[model samples]
Target: MKAKVYVTLKKGVLDPQGKAVANALETMGYKEVKGLRIGKFIEIELDGASQKDGEKRVKEMCEKLLANTVVEDYRIEIV
Candidate 1:
């Protein structure tokens, strides 16, 4: 099984990196660029006995290391 994970900062958290990118875009004349948010994408290939098992493992991976739940949210999709 393959899992795609997205980890992103939750709303209301200060994103300095995103802010810098947005500011650079504005300076470069991208007037339509209103905002920018950065996130992480992790694609993992795993061998599991069943979909349920894969989900459980992926959930553990996200919670234990992939994401910082206090300031970020994560979504996992199996493919």
Candidate 2:
């Protein structure tokens, strides 16, 4: 089984890095770039787990370590 996790800052959180990237893009003449946000993508491989089980485990991993629940939200996908 394989799983993917996406971690991103929640609304209302300060994203200095994302802002910086957006500014750089604007400076480079990408004026259509109105906003940007930074995030993390994690891929994991699992052995002998069904799709349901894999998704559950990946969710636990995100809650425990992969994402900071206070300011970040995560989404999980199993394949």
| Top candidate when judged by TM-score against the true structure | 2
Candidate 2 stretches with Cα past 4 Å from truth are none
Model 2: per-residue lDDT, tens digit, 9-54?
9999999999999999999999999889999999998999778877
lDDT by residue for model 1 over 1-79, one digit each (tens)? Answer: 8999999999999999999999999999999998899999999999855888898899999999999999999999999
What value does the lDDT take at residue 10 in candidate 1?
97
Cα TM-score per model: 0.91, 0.97
* Top lDDT prediction, candidate number: 1
Which pairs in model 1 have colliding backbones? none
Q: Model 2 Cα displacement at 34 (Å)?
A: 0.9
What C-alpha lDDT values do all the predictions have? 0.94, 0.93
Clash count for each candidate, listed in order shown: 0, 0
* Model 1: CA > 4 A from native: none
